[model samples]
Target: MHGVRIETDRLILRPTAADDFDAWAECMADPEVNRFLGGPQPRAVAWRNFMTMAGCWSLQGFGMFSVIERSTGRWVGRLGPWHPEGWPGDEIGWGLMRDTWGKGYASEGAAATMDWAFDTLGWTQVIHSINPENHASIGVARKLGSTLLGPGKLPAPFEDDVVDLWGQTREQWFARRRR
Candidate 1:
């Protein structure tokens, strides 16, 4: 079954669907957007990666959501809570198309995502795996009230790429929200 959907003032986020392949693939192929995310992948590779996110929903009950701009009904990218097998920690991550950058969509989606993760998923903490050179994402993390927690490594395929783990506990997130 398909996972639940989340709506914000300007966006609609839902579980990845097969029909989203085109927009999803395009996002993966954009070098500007894909620079720090394993580089621009071919359409074929994007398909496999696409399935992984969709599969995570069926197999794990949660994963990235295909974000859509409500005004245009355009699939922007994927963003949400994700914690796969062998993950370093629970995380609410994001990757928006280059065109969607600077619009506060990531920050908006992240706030809603973190709320769901903490209130519904019952997660006590969240971590963001960010490459050192990825300054854009680092800004987003800071906007979300996350700070570097030291170095960490991802599981296979990304094992060699060390990342800075940035995050905060659910208590911390809520406490930040109150202010």
Candidate 2:
């Protein structure tokens, strides 16, 4: 599981580093950014969350990557696949700083990761779980051609919300990509 870097038209998706603390923390601290995911977290908590995400790559063979802009090289957010505790299968997740919202970076980066999950990793299925009220993420799921797999939940490390699960199987992915 060597480090993987994915490039898009306007963004770079790469492994996160210690230097990303400030930017990542800022995003996690933004109320708008964290609203659907248990709200803004304290700095210390956010750092721990980032570290957990970083550690997942080593432990799980696949995990989210920090989303950076190509021109400014600024951290915009994170997008990739993860194996969340108790999830039935691989989960695809994405988050962007409040300031970077509405730019389609989430969808773009997520689509890239979906490609890798299916084409590179040979995964048969990938899930995207979000709170039902999170319209932004719902839109991203649609953009990536994922289908609603109905409701599901994983034990909360923070709160008690039942996350809505969306999914894309390898057959669906290949079908969508062909269009």
Model 2: colliding residue pairs: none
Candidate 2's residue-wise lDDT over 1-179, tens digit each? Answer: 64688999999988888899999989989998888878899999998999898888778777788999998999989889888777667888998988888888988899898888887778899998888888889999998898789887676563377677899888988898898
Reference-based lDDT, residue 132, model 2: 89
Q: In model 1, where do residues sit more than 4 Å from their true spots?
A: 1-3
How many Å off is the CA of 56 in candidate 2?
A: 0.6
lDDT of 1: 0.92
Candidate 2 Cα RMSD after full superposition onto the native fold (Å): 1.4
Q: Where in model 2 is the C-alpha error above 4 Å?
A: none
Candidate 1, which ten residues in sequence have the lowest lDDT sum? 1-10
- What TM-score number comes out for model 1? 0.97
TM-score of each: 0.97, 0.94
